[model samples]
Target: MKYIVCFSGGHSSALCAIECVRKVGKENVVLLNHNISEEVEDKDIKRFKQEIADYLGIKITYANMEGWEYKTPLRVCKELGGFKFGNGPALCTYNLKTKPFYKWLRDNFPIEKGSIRDDVRIIYGFDKNEPSRIQRRIGVMINQGYKCEFPLAFWDRTITCTEEIGIARPNTYKLFKHANCKGCLKSGKQQWYLTYCLYPELWEEAKQVENEIGYSIIKGSFLEELEPKFARMKCKGIVPTEKIKPQTFWAMVRKEIPDKSENLPCECAL
Candidate 1:
């Protein structure tokens, strides 16, 4: 059976691809990479894609969203009205990622008339830790007449050797375990704070997008409104230089809050 694995050029998605290749073999698997406008300018993102492509030896199908363009949650909020709590960046996901993914699936692999082979399953690389996100993905797939599987979800539930090592070797310990867009609105203030310190250019770009759209991804606060507040709260957080290591940040976040698995309200971006 043919399987299409959605690739966001992030670690989670890469892990998902690796697992799929392990299960389905590389030939029957396709790496469907979405080329959202923001992502197009990211050199690190491009490198990630290349790394995955070289490692997998699978052709990456770069797909654009056609008429759809990158719009932050702030943009959507502005179009709808003023930004409010839980507005802006959240809505951006639906337009740029989820909706585009659905559209691509419809155009390339129709659901009706048994268009997809019966054995086909869409695999998402949501780690075992993110149950809410997995559930949401499953819900969306069901609505689209597809089945979803989460290999990492089960793995993430149990403590591992890696965790033991990470605990002992704190500096060696990687922070920030989850993977998605660098400035994804779903990411909390800490993550955004790290992004601001590490990739100031991208962070500034995100701010510009928010300003241009005249909304804030963080609902009640615009970037301009939130920046001063973020500046005031100072911590000896690791200042990322040059490259932002995704794995390191994931580990750091996980370390700070061991039981932070609760789902925030879906910002309707996805």
Candidate 2:
């Protein structure tokens, strides 16, 4: 059986790729990735992906969107017409990620007789805490005649390959929750605030995209409308680190800036 790992350049996915090699041997494992433009994706993420692929003795098979060789997220949103926020259908993700992935699949592994491909298993990096996501993914892949596995979901403990393999993780994990695009349009206010503070140029581009598209990346507030609030927090030295809860981070911010607003939501549109 060939184990094709959806090798997203995140810590969890990196571990999944390593564990897949350990289980089935490197010969039977394929590290499949979707390459985003460097302008959107961080350079450290690209480095980590290469390092992990090198460690596993396999080259990453990139599934790239044909026309979007170097399009940023904001550019994708602008050209795609509008950005969908918070659980709605996101055109950028579908066009940039999902469509290309399925195209690659069709080109490589054709479905025969409308049945699941028993000789191939697709691996995802969802952890044990995400039962609902796991089930949903299973449903989607099954419908498409693909079998799926979640190593992190079944493992007793987490497997982070960075320490054992001596490869430095992408720097995104140090500040952001996921190693997503630098200014991910699907992210919540917390991530946007962090982007505003760290990547002002990307933030400015996002604001411009919002203006061109005539809608906000966030549900109700344009980035321009939200910039002043983020500026205040930045002036007060408030920022987010990886995996910090929304309520807790906001409490710390309130201590410094004292906003009477209710706790902000940090759930991204994953």
Q: Which tens-of-lDDT digit does each residue in 76-116 have in candidate 2?
A: 77887888645666878887888888888878888976788
lDDT of 2 at 239: 59
Positional deviation of residue 228's Cα in model 1 after best superposition, in angstroms: 2.9
TM-score of 1: 0.65
lDDT of 1 by residue, 114-144 (tens): 3433666777767767889988888867777
- In terms of TM-score, which candidate is strongest? 2
TM-score of 2: 0.90
Candidate 1, run of 10 with poorest lDDT: 164-173
Best by lDDT: 2
CA shift of 88, model 1, Å: 11
**Local distance difference test, candidate 2:** 0.82
| Model 2 regions lying over 4 Å from their true place | 85-88, 155-159, 240-243, 260-270
Q: After superposition, how far is residue 58 of candidate 2 from its true place, in Å?
A: 0.4
